[model samples]
Target chain A: MIRSITQKKTEEELDQLLTGIARIFIIGCGTCVTMTHTGGTPEVTEIKEKLLKKGKLVTGDLVLPVACDNLTAEVLHENRSKIDLADGLLILTCAFGVQTIARQVKKTTIPGLDTLFIGKETGLGQFDEICTQCGSCILGETGGVCPVTSCHKGLVNGPCGGTKNGKCEIDEKKDCAWTLIYNRLKDLNRLDLMKRYQKPKNFQREPRPGKYWLTPT
Target chain B: MVSLFKKALESKKFVVTSEVAPPKGTNLEKIKHHIELLKNKVDGINITDHQSSVMRYPSLGGALLVKEMGGEPILQMTCRDRNRLALQADLLFAYSRGISNVLCLTGDSILMGDHKEAKGVFDMDSSQLVATIRKLEKGKDLGGNDLDGAVSFCAGAIVTPEANPLEPQLIKFEKKVEAGAEFIQTQAIYDLDLFKHFMEYAEQFPVKVLAGVILLTSAQMARFMNKNVAGVNVPQNLIDELSTAPKGRAIEKGIEIAGRMIKKIRKQKLCTGVHIMAIGREELVPEIMSAAELG
Candidate 1:
């Protein structure tokens, strides 16, 4: 599950940001961002209408079914003329999607959305952080709970003697991630997994500018 | 050699220790004073590892200083800042430096600290950290590779007797015991009845339990902790006492509250001993012990 986040900026703010550029191309993602209503056909349509009402030209608009996929390159190429018609582009997608599309096209891309964190959809219109994207994965040792994201202190070795009534020390609303992990492991009878001391994470694996590409088949 | 605190754990008598959060900067004068004052009064001095995820002088360095100052040092190791490699190396260093006692804890989240963006390397949970210490004692690393020499430790872990939904905390506590934690220093406790209930189950395990006592300075402090700090509860009476303290004597009232808690824990034989967390009030430990009749 992907976490689709919305920025606090409004239509007026977006209009203010596009001061000079009359003709604009708007792009949104159908997968993650669409779910958040921040980057979808509806959102793109809304922005296009607002721009038209502001007397600016709405050159083109497309909500790529999936913007972060390898196929984004092909999609950008397919929509090249529609995109080239605009003076600039407004990307209502995550950083990953914006950068992915930007690399394929040479047009100046304006990020209309704020990229939040990697998280899971907790409920309808609700999301919570689940993974930190730390280079190394240790959920096996933690009984499938991601302490990196769960603990307020993000303590991997956890609970930190600060939890009260199974809730976090810092946030009373949240369950203590360690306590949850412990209880989960106990229920699974896999508490033995918690016995192994995890060495420090090899952050080098998830260094900044992280990129990966599988060899062509 | 086994540390004196280790001996106390093995013995039936109650054990007493206190925390000394190392300075944020290089100024060691304050910690040095706390250590010197507490050296003879308590069984061990726990050097916290960035206590609330805020960066500070290393616990390993503080443990070494405790050793130098003639205090039994319990080096607290958290999996927050260091990975397994750094953790193992620090353990080896602690053992080599003759700092024997260890308190294994899953450290506080880095978000709670000054550095909000720092990545947490919870490579190991507290249970794993405790088990790792055992592995080191067996002269081997986690990879099953033999070490240059064997290390001996008086290892311990923390427990929250005051935890709501106490079942999960108990589960973790039991896991810590199975992972080789010989002693447990509980989170700060105020309600004695709650601790008594926790101890009823805790006694079945083969581990020592030290009730944690955090010195309450004021009603505001108590309210702040209740709201902000997890696993901590300051009874309304105690808060009222702190509020009514004459002028600047609030600290004295706090001292009395801590001393009184220690006295009751000892009087009731609550568990093993008391682990006093005076927060920044380390100098008042001797007085606390005196009032508790521990001196």
Candidate 2:
């Protein structure tokens, strides 16, 4: 399943962010973060205890089915009284959920976790980023391997000098994308495609802050 | 109107080249001294561009300095920090200033350097960068716009001859050659038999190959490279030799080792020439060359 991988922010950063606000209401997601054990029920309860231990009032807390879902607005309304009792909302979810809560709630919203990447759960508690959504996909030529996301340098030509024994230079555990592509193409007897010169990627295809609207037929 | 470095490559008389890394700060004293010392000693001096992804004085500025000091500058342009437009613009500027040689590299990963947080802009890999230079020489840019003035250069790229799973690296090498890389500089090689095998394959390509020789300062550094560096396998015997160096004379011993390798490479006509990399010990290049009997 596609999961939004996230890591909890450091306590020091959270402490600095929550200063000057006493009462706190925590929110957690029951979807992706729940599977990752990052912002599930236990994490929300744990944060509440941590906040209470720091002499802060825990007004209330709950784990919504999907913090990023539109139902977040309705759920916040259902618990409006308890949420209003706090100075701010400590959201223990991905940035998408935190932003959704911030947009719906008038109280100050602080993100308790940082979103790392949108990755697929490859194994038990393991995630691997597969695509960058660069908009101009060349998977057809690269034998289904996305170099944009797989290669550390996002090189389209082939492996850089840093590839050693099919591992990336950044980390020995990470597989080199070009090596994977070479092996795949070599298997398919399409090694000639690897030799083709790939021009500079067209950044204009998907400019930053991308947006699109479907035209009604 | 061939560049001097290009002429040397064509001259086929064991062309010797080295590199000078730009400083991290504004001080040019060290770089200037190195350039002045090496201008007449080597055919061309490559000015490294934020080598190993550590931000430093730009290679363009250092190449200009080499030109100012009457030295042949081979600008080392990497795809780690610049987009296609910036790279083409820098190439134009370098050509306008009489800098003629360029060594195209798909630079080291940014994580390897001090600025671990910086964004790495690999807009074009080293092979594409070589192709871009060839395209620019035809009075056009990558954007397909005509230039008022065309640029010419002795373009080159690097290869890791000892890279594990060497086929992928060889594929990239062939692509670079097909993209018009006139010269090829290899990563530091210690195993001559392995390098000879690489050369046997490289001999099929129509490009001048320069064997890369990095000076080993100490045994610990050698071991560190063998452990930490990718594709740089320092044979255990060489490491033992460095470890056995008498006290503080390891640097001289290292020079002896590097010089001996170069002497052997040259005597055997291993490749077209040797591209010596003294790393931080740029001052010792001439000594190394002397030891190799090239001086």
Candidate 3:
């Protein structure tokens, strides 16, 4: 899943960097990050109002449909004159959106938010990490349960001695990921699948800054 | 080594067991006294593993103490604290130490425990833990690595007959039995008639069933357990009785109630045994047994 995350930066921190700059443009995201109310149109509007109250001129704002999309670059080029009037760009979206905007704009782009993690909403107003972008998938052997991301210790052949009553010994609030995988496999009556000792995860950290491709169509 | 508990399960007579909650500190005097007092009276002594999600001295440590004091220990193992590797390793350790009986549990949610910030490592639930014991007995661990020596255990798991939505619990009960659980202990059960209903469905399985009897020391304790403890429904009548008990005689009343239930369970041969959870009230378990006329 193309998941985004929550913002952690505060308004005051954003204001500190914008010190003497008069006019400021705000940009938000309409997709994934927006799902958490971080970079939505309303949030961008709220920030604009705050900037106006701070005595800084609010040039304009836009909640792009997927702030990381290349189309956002085109939107920035179209509003170049409005952006040029401002000393910097205030980003309410994630790091990807901030960087994307920065690449296209002459003005310094300052991020107003810090991204949290790649997770999905597991319950009403609750988001849980379902994947760690491990670059490889092992859900089939684990009875459709993802152990790498769910487990705190992330043991492939798991259940260290500290586990008590299916709770993680490290962090008691979280469910033991390996325990979950075991139960799921048991219910499916495919417990034999757990017999195969999975080798330590090859995190595929090679070629440091990772990239993915399909053959250029 | 096969435990006396295993022998009791195979016997025709009613069996008895009681639990001991290890102290939060390093003091083992209370545990030693309880073991000395009730060791021979009951079939086995259960040492709780961080029961109710609260961290106490390790149950395994207490189990070793029980063995040292010449008492049979059913090491209570929960899936909350450790992952599979640790679980299997501990089982090996327990087996090596001659602590052979195990009560496998999925454990209470960490949200209910002393450590709220702690993460629950439910790498496996109770059902899975039972299966793991069976696998260990077969000469290999969950990862299929052959061991230097295989282990054997009289494995057990928990059931909550009085759970409000019992169908899910029933499903888990069946799964636990299927996972090679030889005996099943329940959470605190008050209403005998309600327990009878649970037994009606439970009788079809081959596993032994032990009705859990948590001593109701006072009305407040009963109400508190009713509100906080899952699957433990203290009927209004028991609460009413505790409420009317003469001041400072609540323990006597609690013993009388526990005795009455055990007496009835034995008289009717309802199940294989009664697992008494005299939490923090270990000194009074013998009185409960005497009141039941078990001795």
Per lDDT, the best of the predicted structures is 2
Better of 1 and 2 by DockQ: 2
Candidate rank order under TM-score:
2, 1, 3
- The TM-score values for the models, in the order shown, are 0.82, 0.96, 0.73
**Candidate 2 at A206: error in angstroms?**
2.2
Worst 10 residues of 1 chain B by lDDT: B163-172
Model 3 interface Cα RMSD in Å: 9.6
* C-alpha lDDT of residue B122 in model 1: 72
lDDT tens digits, residue span B174-253, model 2 = 99999999999999999999998888889998999999999999999999998888899999999899988899989988
Give stretches of model 2 more than 4 Å off: none
Worst 10 residues of 3 chain B by lDDT: B163-172
* Candidate 3 residue lDDT tens string, A1-217: 5467777477677768888778888888888767888778888888888888879897888778888889998888888777778888888888888888888887878888887777888777677888877777889888777877776645555444334456565465777676677778779988667665454345545455877567754
- Candidate 2 whole-model C-alpha lDDT, 0 to 1: 0.93
- Candidate 2 TM-score, true structure as reference: 0.96
Model 1 per-residue lDDT tens digits across residues A79-106: 8888888888999998888889888888
lDDT of 1 by residue, B63-133 (tens): 99999989999999988888888899998888889999999988887778899888877777788888889
Which parts of model 3 are misplaced by more than 4 Å? A1-27, A32-36, A45-62, A70-91, A94-217
Of candidates 3 and 1, the better by lDDT: 1
